[model samples]
Target: MDLPQLGTNLLNRVPPRLLSAAERYLKSVPLLRNRLEKETDSMLAGLEGDLKPYRGQLPTFATLPTQGLSHEQVLGEMSQMKEKEEHRWKDGLVSGAVYHGDSEHIDFLNRVYALNSQSNPLHADLWPSATKFEAEVVAMTAHMLGATEANAGRPPEQHICGALSSGGTESIMLAMKTYRDWARETKGITRPEMVAPSTAHTAFDKAAHYFGIKMVRVPVGPDYRADVKATRKALNRNTIVIIGSAPSFPHGTIDPIEELSELARKRRIGFHTDACLGGFVLPWARKLGYPVPEFDFRLPGVTSMSADTHKFGYAAKGTSVVLYRGTALRSHQYFTATEWPGGIYFSPTFSGSRPGALIAAAWASLVSTGEEGYLDATRRILETADAIKRGIRAIPGLHVLGEPLFVIAFGSDIVDIYKVMERMSARGWSLNGLHKPAAVHICVTQRHTQPGVAERFLEDLRAAVEHVRANPGEKGTMAPVYGMAGTVPFRGILSDLLKKYMDLLYKV
Candidate 1:
């Protein structure tokens, strides 16, 4: 009998509980554990060269040197590494990593960072400038995402309020933490849960794991957006919040936020729109006449949002904004201990001492790149994305996954899509490989907006398709890895592999 038939037969012979316990026992067995570790080691060994290219060539400082290295020597080594790495993203050969790589913009942000290097928001009295910059950054981001409309008749307390977090993950985790605390304190709910579409960013899962909140992931619709009905059904008395992404990370399709948030509103539960990817682009896109939906504070049901200033906002990498409908809700995100003998202590977000230079850089990026700058950048990015999407669809076996603005995901019906992705990588293109439905995505940025970059991408992509189609039997580096990751039925094995891979990163 086939493996599937044998599994079915075994399942029929044994109760699910017993089968699960037996599987756990088998996984825990010394021999099985050793085999799993061997498999994980093999996979990671293949990735080690790429992950640790400078391991032997450069200094591996597991501990600091007794004497400080000269600034010139340290900078020389750093410059060499930067020179090696910058070409790919600098020339638009990659995706998403370096959003705005223009020399002038980078230099300007660097100068801003240098000027504010010593400043820390934790010492507000010492560095009042950091406080002003953070407040203005939040206000500007909130206004851009419909705070003006949402707070037209409301007081300062009722107006949209937020804190600057380290990045999208921090922003999202902060919001989830806020909801957990709010629900526990107000609703007296001990077992809190959050409902979100499966397509939502994995940060929500991280938050769920970290904060002891149960995450109920509803499946996306046929179009790959969040399924409103399924999400509504996932909610219960213990549900503290519902999350929807404005252009989710995988497929770049915006969820039906209006409907999902409305459900949360009627229930008096929190609704968080994760706009980390789309927050900076969508508002400008809407102004330029894209079919942008209402996913921000303009919607009465949206109680909170998380937007990354680093990505499309064209700032230094560390800043993100997490906004709440009102100060009352945001207060739950704060950490305070007035009774501490050290002193009265309080922090707005997770971090106590933050890189205020990055906050200053975020401020500079926003102020310098005003509405006109963002509008122009958004226009170029969207145009490039449209061309790329059309090009992918034009390929014989490939199809673009959903309606997307800047991030375009495409899959194949007749080709080994991962092999195609591997071919693209061979041709100097770095793309995101997605599972669930085997696909690859390229997030369009200003780098791709440069002259000939989009054309080169499309041409290389077409050539990659043809290459994969011609070389059907040829094994490729990442293709087998992606194939195994996608098709493996034992998810625990994959999780263990990932954990081991993370362990590899810490090795000197």
Candidate 2:
């Protein structure tokens, strides 16, 4: 217990021998467990201030008030908070939070939401419009992702079809569950595992934990694409599915889905390309003649995909698409019950009752922002992303990672990137911190493509990098946290700290 121990099970498809033994030895000690808990609590205390910005402001409520507050009061307080938050994201100072922030688009989606506020897809028998909207949204998404070409000779049951989930995480989790069930029933694989690139979304990890699916994380190649050879070697008889990202969240580099999927094809296993961040952007980027790699239904091996309608689809937040190559595969994602007290019920997604208003807004966004709309948006976004990339690379200390179309991560050799990130935050720019090799990223969206937005970003970034370079010994905000996150080999301590952070998130 003197040293940190690793978690058991497959880390990068299999655990390190020393880690596995260490994990067991340390886990047996009572004092180590207690000390770990105390350390995690202390680490979480450091993050509490940032997590709870309104801790001392406003009238906080851990539970609903005995009587509801006046609507005007609620509105006033919410408006104030929104105003505080809006400036950062609205002015294009943050990364990946807001996609399309044009007031016209925002107003339009808001109107759509208000119109269908009471609608619920669970009672689709009553709200058929919701059903219609969701169906069309799926169909529209499929067509854009090459489903038409892939399903040319296939039956409707074998055509690309999907359901709407709350977000990217839900879409991903549902897909993993579907794969687990599909593999078990069809392929006689009792034990299920999913193989994914190291750069793949963490939602896959969540899925693995949630549905008892073993996740095999394989390393990415030098190009930051999935190592197809390594993936093949990692796959076992129980591996139900393989995954590659259409420009994964971290590196923003598209995995070689064509090659990866073909490997999955040869093995007769499902291949899922998670385009959560890139799905809505990539097709348009490709059409715009950007150097986009093949990472879609065009590949015969891509059996499933997840695309965030909320991210690049310009929909309100709470919507995402999870598509299967065929209804047969998607059917496994559905949950059905019969002979219950609540008589003969079925839910297409995880939630029994779903907010149809978001789906309505999603539908509206897709239709209103037609092919032309997407083309224009992608054009601006790509241009801005290109500019940002150029600026980052031009910086003396920084270097860009991989050939990325939109979401960009840059690392520094001369300054602590995390400290630079902290400096950016003080200047009202929020960004993401990355590790393994320390770096930071900004996932560019339409918001970032606004006039002067990219230029302003580079200006702030240069100043921030300079500030960090000037202040050598200064332990800037979040730098210590990031450093601890990266250097702390005790994953149990990190995971426990993360849990406490989550607990703070739920604090009223």
Candidate 3:
């Protein structure tokens, strides 16, 4: 075996703590550190062209102009960039990024954004309209996700309450931080931990890292759902909350939230349902007769949830709702200072000042789309997803990962799926590449419901698979990177690579 592979095998056998220590020690060696830096620099250099295509073609500004450019000049430059970049997503070749690309909807949201551009939710007195929009957006999302049923017999204090967030990540982090504070103040648990399935969003891990909570990830079952028994075994006295996804990001399979949340409730702990992806779609999917499990406030054990108005809700980007079962729990998510030199201050979410325009757009989306519009959109998306799923299954080597509704993940037994993804990318398809099982997925949106998109996707996918099968010896740029990311045992190396990539993104 090669030396690098042999070293990786040895590193894989080491315990996690020891492996981490080894990673530190190895990085301390100048030769190894230099080698890693060189390799990463070489790898990223090849990607700089694709990442910064506007360089040399457009003005590169490292320093601001002494005087601002004219409005017409600025708009002209932006229009050029927009025209160049909008086609892939506008043509229904991209995934998840653009949920509603209709011209009329875009124009309507743009108008709403322009009208509320100066408003800020932080100054509620000055922008009561922003407050109204934020509150109503949260309420509309809550009601859509069974808040009315959940609050039927409860008092106002115990009714579903929430705050508007920047996006799914912020919403999830707010909920996790709330749980940590609630557990500390109420249950005296300082060293807090959370139990979640492996497939739960990584935002939970980000929360754990930020809030100093211990995240205990349990395994999933053969059907790609959370293993309730394993979750039960992972819990301890320090576990303040348990997490389940309405439908996870990678496999798109809903966890057993019914069982998992009940376990949390029986322990008198918190349960958070991450419905960021499925929250806006599954409600309508259930109404349309899809076999969606109980995963929201309708269940008695669910203490919190996050729903992105930006995703399937067809709202503009940068808006989401985070809901809690009671005002008492949500109070922990709030921040207040009484003795500050400036004055007494408070904020509901993570930010001190948030974009009221996004809130207004979210409110507008929820109100304008209404239930009927969401139902129609969900129907079209699910139908398109079903057709794509069938097409993937009909292909010889590929198999669908699970019974997914909108986000469909598929893998191949006879070929490298990453190569197929690269082929798809070459054909203007922007797909999500998943590791652990080495698969690729397309998050079906309103764009994919456009005429002929589904057929084109299937035809391209078949040809991509055939090409990969015929040319097994061919190497592609991204396939090896993905293959190494999925197979390499040294996670620290991959983490370093990602950090470098993030640094590359900031280069002007």
List, in order, the clash count of every candidate structure: 0, 0, 0
> Model 2 clash pairs?
none
Deviating ranges (above 4 Å) for candidate 1: 1-23
lDDT of 3 by residue, 1-508 (tens): 8998688678778899987887888889999999989988888898989999999888889999999999998999999999999999999999899999999999999999999999998999999999999889988899999999999988999999999999999999999999999999999999999999988999999999999999999999877899999999999999999999989999899999999999999999999999999999999999999999999999999999999999988889999999999999999999999999999999998999999999999999889998899999999999999999999999999999978889899998899999999999999999999987889999999999999999999999999999999999988888988988976766898899999999999999
C-alpha-based local distance difference test score of model 1: 0.92
State TM-scores per candidate: 0.96, 0.94, 0.98
When 1 and 2 are scored with lDDT, the better candidate is 1
Candidate 3: C-alpha RMSD to true structure equals: 1.5
Q: Tell me the deviation in Å of residue 344 in model 1.
A: 0.7
**Candidate 2: misplaced stretches above 4 Å?**
1-42
TM-score of 1: 0.96
Give the Å error, residue 31, model 3. Answer: 2.4
Q: After superposition, how far is residue 237 of candidate 2 from its true place, in Å?
A: 1.2
Which lDDT tens digits does candidate 1 get at residues 167-222?
A: 99999999999999999999999999999998999999999999999999999988
Q: Which has the better lDDT: candidate 1, or candidate 3?
A: 3
Q: Please report how far candidate 1 places residue 404 from its true position, in Å.
A: 0.9
| Stronger candidate by lDDT (2 vs 3) | 3
Query: Evaluated with lDDT, which candidate comes out highest?
Result: 3
